[model samples]
Target: MSNRSIGLDGPLYDYLLEHSLREPEILAELRAETANLPEANMQIAPEQGQFMALLARLMGARRYLEIGTFTGYSALAIALALPEDGTVVTLDKSAQWTTTARRYWERAGVSGRIRLELGEAGNTLQALEAEGETSRFDLAFIDADKTGYPDYFEHCLRLVRAGGLILVDNTLWHGSVADPDDTREDTRAIRAFNDALHHDERIDLSLAPIGDGLTLARRR
Candidate 1:
């Protein structure tokens, strides 16, 4: 796939991170600590975190849901930006990884605002559905397993209220979505998700060329 998006490369990426992203010291430390982790790629960029925070504020979101916690960076970002009464339910099955996430959440003093649910994402989502959680979330972020994106989207759509926002990460699949030669399962799944989203009439969608591609779907 062609990397048509104007992303900062090597030196430029570092330069932007240093000069533009004024990340807090604690957040920076957390990012550094997880830099070598197997799922380090799951951490959202500082710019992306800032954007999500802004969206949360702009939407006046009080009840949020996140499909993946990943060391709690994004959850922390959103919590910090939300109102005092706001709450976030973050899902991830890894207790090992979430140990780090919980540490940071407590350190940030946002532990009360976040609930860490450890289990298969689909099962947790299904449970939420069974609990009659439809239209209860003001905002939802999906960035978990790629193969399950479609399921996540469907559930999140039901969970988020009308006019709420659902943000899907990695829609571009590192440029693989546009590559005809790429037949990997993750890439194919992402392609199918994108195609379905393009025609889906339930939401107003825009596939932004943000970090790894982010799709914003505002429920109608």
Candidate 2:
């Protein structure tokens, strides 16, 4: 079997976006603004955001949860996809970055649908659990620090309803996870997380070869 794909090599990816991407003006503006940041790479690719939004819509997700909220592009996409009654609870520790996020959410007029929490994700997750939020979310997206991926998945698994979906970002770690000599902390953690998910029976799994790699786990 060959892993080679024409899209990764050249114009195919650009064509994919040209024909398929229907980014709202607000989202385009947000993406453009985020592109200037020093940590801009942290943003998920636009196509990936669109993909996740379609998934949320397909699953009829009414309650959404996001573990990482960098500039809020992903949240905005999900919020737009959800119905008026849908809600998204997103967690992030960066007040500075999330301030940018909040501005965009307000611009998109989805601020009311999204609740932003500023603190350690673990603390927030535990708090949600204590508030009887078990199985409360219809979908959860884990894009936080890679070291916390394992714990985040555990919490999201419990917070999201049975049969709900969990999306984990950067599972491929920019192709570094396939290189044994990398030995980076983030890479190792992602590798372990991927291995664990592959064996875990609580969910069905598929690691998609999308931007930076996205792993989909559906609770049983």
Candidate 3:
């Protein structure tokens, strides 16, 4: 056996879910619904959602933030884990996708806890900063456009409290980041972001080999 994380084959993945996944019925239903969408691949894996939810609970997160809310699955995952008084502000440009997300959120009865900000995420973030919202969030998740990741992370660093956590999705870009020959713009952007994060002293970082690769950066 190698001294590293074990790669999950189909059977092993099924077993992992069978033994550990505690996905709620509502979440399962949402996943099923999102599966039929044209951008279904944009949805985060259920297991990844569960992991983020647990992490939120462990950190006692309250004021959560999200950069890209694809169909609201990830946001729902975090919102569901929050206490009644907790809130999540999710930003996305597409009214269509967010409308779908809103439906699921309403159905889950967690709609009241999530605020949707539909606009250019970068500008929205700047507005928040201009309003003197510094270190205001407990956790911020980034799953937006790959090119915007660096900017999103910078804003998240300001919005998240000292010692707060920032979760970046698709850091691996579906394994493209590790492929030297993948010269695609998105791949390059992800690689650049990862490299910068690796050397950044303002946060403590760890790249997890979960759904599409998740990077955890805790502000210092």
Q: All candidates' lDDT scores? A: 0.90, 0.95, 0.94
In model 1, which residue pairs have backbone atoms overlapping below 3 Å?
none
Compute each candidate's TM-score over C-alphas. Answer: 0.93, 0.97, 0.97
Predict model 2's lDDT versus the native. 0.95
Model 2 Cα displacement at 151 (Å)? 0.5
Cα-based lDDT at residue 73, candidate 1: 87
Q: Which stretches of candidate 3 lie over 4 Å from their true place?
A: none
Give one clash count per candidate, in the order shown: 0, 0, 0
Native-to-model Cα distance after best TM-score fit, residue 106 in candidate 3, in Å: 1.1
- For each of the candidates, the C-alpha root-mean-square deviation to the true structure, in angstroms, is 2.8, 1.5, 1.0
- lDDT by residue (150-200, candidate 1, tens digit) is 999999999999999999999988889889999999999999999999999
Tens-digit lDDT string for candidate 3 (1-220): 6899778889999999999999999899989999999899999999999999999999999989999997899999999999999999999999988888999899999999999999999999999899887899999999999999999999999999998999999998888888999999999999999999999999999999998999999999
Compare candidates 1 and 2 on TM-score and give the better one: 2
